[model samples]
Target: MEQPAATYPVHGPSLRKRRMALGLTVQEAADKAGISRSYLQRLETGIRERMGPKRYTRLRTALNATNDQISPPPEIPTEER
Candidate 1:
C-alpha cells in the first residue's frame, strides 16, 4: 500500500496575516474556528506552535487558507523595496 504525504504545522505569522486580511478580530476568528480567543492569540503570537487536526481544519477554513498560503513569506530588506 502507498503511504500518504506528511503535513506540517501552520505558520503563526501567516495565520495572523490571513486573519487580518479577512477582517476578522481574534475573537471573531476564534469563534469561527471553534477555539478560544486566548488560544488563537497564542497561535498568532507563537506561544503555541501546533494544533490538532480538528482545530487545524477549523482554523484553516475560518482563515480561508490553502496549504500554499499557510507559510509566511520571506522578509524583504528595506533596501530591496
Candidate 2:
C-alpha cells in the first residue's frame, strides 16, 4: 500500500512574526524571497495555503527561520491506498 503525499497548511502568523522579528518590510522580504510583495502579503495574512517546498524554502531563507519555526502544521494521516 502506498501512503498519500503529505500536505501541510501554511502558518501565516508565524511567517509574519518571523519577518517582523528580522526587521524586514514586506517588500524587502518579498524581494529576498524572490516573490511578489502582494504574494508575500497574502501569505502573511493567511489568504494563501499549502506552500510547496521550493517557495517555502525561499521564504524560510528570507526570514531566517529555523526548520522548526518554518515547519507547517502536520498533515493528517490518511488511509493507505
Q: Pick the candidate with the highest TM-score.
A: 1
lDDT of 2: 0.81
Q: Residue by residue across 1-81, what tens digits does model 1's lDDT show?
A: 975334347678888899999999999999999999999998889888677777888889999899668755556878755
Off by over 4 Å in 2: 1-8, 72-81
Error of 1 at 75 (Å): 13
- In terms of lDDT, the poorest run of 10 residues in model 1 is 2-11
Residue pairs in clash, model 2: none
Backbone clashes for every candidate come to: 0, 0
